[model samples]
Target: MARSIFPFLLLFLFTYYYTGVQSHEEGYVTAEISNKGLEFLKDLLIEKAESSLVPLELPKIEKSVKIPIIGSVQMVLSNITIEKIHVTSSTVKTGDTGILIDVSGATANLSMNWKYSYSTWLLPISVSDKGSATVQVEGLDIGLTLSLNTLQGSLKLSLLECGCYVNNISIKLNGGASWLYQRLIDAFEGKISSSVEDAVSKKLKEAIPKLDSVLQSLPKEVSVTDIAELNVTFVDEPELSGSSLDLQINGLFYAKNEVAHSKHYHKMLKASDSCNEADKMVKISLHENVLKSASSVYFEANKMHWMVDEVPDQSLLNTAGWRFIVPQLYKKYPNRDMNLNLSVSSPPIIEVENQRISAIIPLDFVIDILDADELIPVACISMVISSSGSAEISGHALAGNLKLNDFTMSLKWSNIGDFHMHLIQTVMSTMLKTVILPFANLKLSKGLQLPVFHGYELQYAQILCTDSWIVICSDVAPVEQLRLV
Candidate 1:
């Protein structure tokens, strides 16, 4: 009976103490929950703040919810619009204990026509589409996890066949060389990246020392990983003509310090890939259509940028300048016949430090024109131009054989009469020697000098007197001359 009584007393004491402890615990939870909402709100503000020592203003702290088991804090905010968002201060409440803080807000005066946007730069830099985001905070670091969902603009990267809209955008760069390079490539290739690159490059050139200082502060073995996914609604209509391309990019890399800081860059060109760097880099391809009436004399480099060592020739352009002259001559005058040959070649290389460039033009062809009946004899007309810039022209025509040295001329209607005049003169002179002289009433030696009027005939008729009376008459029947010797 004594032992049982002692056990009963002990049980009563234990029960009283346990009840008291439970009441105290409940009070602590209640107090903690009440204060936790503000704490979590502050954490979100801190995460959004871009600068330290900067205070953020919110209209009100509406509500805060805390989950004791998971140690998560969710706070709803009012009139919470930050001029800028940055990752600044970080605090850890306890070792090995996880705490998550989240803050969210909305504005009544938002313009539906415009996109909402947010961005932050820190160890984990991120930018988002324009809209409201439900930020969930959960991690062991006692920091806020920002989940930003917004209505972002779609990226129209290249002049391709696609119609789409984007509602959100984000960029997260985990430190690495490959990741950094790819981020830079995408950013540069993206709508905003080109401008950003230009600005940065200009600034770096101006502030090399500052850039070096910043680079020095970073890890030498920088490995960057990034996941940039774009949410796009591709518009495809049967009546509309266009292809669709909605894309996301994710990449990783493990590079050494030396490789990370490698000075051997191919100077990332605009649209073309580096030939030498092909093995060291990956490529993303783009597609476009070949329009039926596109300009033929296009520069390949314009499409390929710096990657193309050689540029296509424009001299063969069928629509302009010299080329136009050939085709037009043929098309406009169906009665006249014309032919053309035009070609181009690369020029010799002239090397400069860190650069080598060459150019060539192959403009080689002969053109011949003939009358409708082909009565005119064939002519051999040629133009020869050397890489050294020497030009020679040689030809034969009814105008007589011509040997031209760097000679250039145009054949027009006015010149045609002069050419025919010279030709006619030549043919007439030859025919006179071969035919008219032999049939004329004059005999002449090959080397004899003849009077101009030697071919005239004179006739005199004379009636003879008994003795020798002389009578001369100009008329052939009335002439009288002594006579018949």
Candidate 2:
């Protein structure tokens, strides 16, 4: 009984292994956006803050006081203007809660006009003062929290030091003294501190959302061609590291209506702590199913064709005619004009085996002969060409060179004689190797380029080939002309 069951066990093992391989091949393509690469964005945010946070106007602060010497005094401060605001350092992070932006060591120059009145209850006296003072803020700290809307946020601000130098001061007293000017300066500094904090906070709350709008407006879809479109979808919330932010995105690439519907395993993505240790700024993984889907789409399009317009040499035609037992035919038409055309018989079949990608292309060849200034089709040949190659990441594109492995030809119809069948087969095989394969490689190289980011360029790309997928990893850095909009 044990011997009889041995065949069944072997069959079961084979089935299990085959199914496992198939399941692994039908997986998702993932892209990782690393943190170190996000530093460029931080710099951009700081620059934007410097330009947009300007001409800030503060609220009016009014108070009534009873002074020992100057009784029944009323003071009003308005028209506070802050300018030349500059952010020296900033830190941005993403977490489970939301996004946090902390700015430190900010400085700005401020100028404001102030007016005050003094009235003594013992005498009929009214004193008024009007002047403009300029102040220098040494260190300011701003903390902001941003939600997804980019348009909603809260800002907290504090100032470490503020010094005001009286640029111009004018005092008017109806019947009192000119010594009150110094007291006004001291009081102004005490009250202006709180006003400065409130102004900065309000300005930041307004500016943060505008920054978010700019970030959201960045282009997401990269168009490779009319038929092929790559959709980058963010699958999970971004995580923040000390130096960078990590984003998990789906690399959904398809040829119109050819996108395969598959379940996304977003839970598989884990928060990375050492994002700075990553060598590449971006990583794109492509599953084998993507190739299969694209191949099917190309086959359905049926647009693969090549035409050779040059006339065949008479000597070569004669040599072919002699082999076909039609020597006198070449003499009758020694200078016959002939051209060759090739069309796909069906869609190409792509397969991945043992770390190599291969394609089986079926083609039809038509040879037209010019007679009496009219082209007449003389021969039709059907053939299959098998090619295999290894893929590599070249610059920002997936590039590969296909080597023709096997060529086979059969004559479907030939008015040029049966022996000439061998000649046509030889010519077609040469064309496949020399002309057609190179053309296909060129198209593949140009068509598979990675999408370009606004300021970053791909560098030192590494490609990984696996049993079911290919992974491309590359570093992206700012170009010399990099600009943030």
Give me the candidate number with maximum TM-score: 2
> For model 2, what is the alpha-carbon lDDT of residue 330?
55
Cα error of candidate 2 at position 48, Å: 1.7
TM-score of each predicted structure versus truth: 0.16, 0.66
Per-residue alpha-carbon lDDT of model 1 for 1-485, expressed as tens digits?
A: 01111221121111111000011000100001112223443454354332431222323332223334433223322333223323333432211212223222311111011121223333253322222322111111112322111111111211111111212233332222334233232231233222222332333233334423442343212121121111111111101111111121111111222221111112211222222322211122111100000111122212101111111232221223223333344343344433232222222111111121111222222233445554232222222222111111111000101111121222223212222334323432342244322322122111112111123111221111111111111111111221221
Per-residue lDDT for 372-405 in model 2, tens only?
8887776687888887767665554545556789
Candidate 1 TM-score to native: 0.16
lDDT of each: 0.22, 0.54
Model 1 deviation from the true structure expressed as Cα RMSD, one decimal place: 44.8
Candidate 2 TM-score, C-alpha based? 0.66
In candidate 1, which residue ranges exceed 4 Å CA deviation? Answer: 1-77, 84-363, 370-384, 388-485
**Highest lDDT, which number?**
2
Backbone steric clashes in candidate 1, count: 28
Candidate 2's C-alpha runs over 4 A off are 1-29, 121-125, 145-221, 232-277, 288-298, 310-335, 350-358, 371-380, 388-402, 410-426, 437-456, 459-470, 481-485
Cα lDDT, model 2, residue 430 = 60
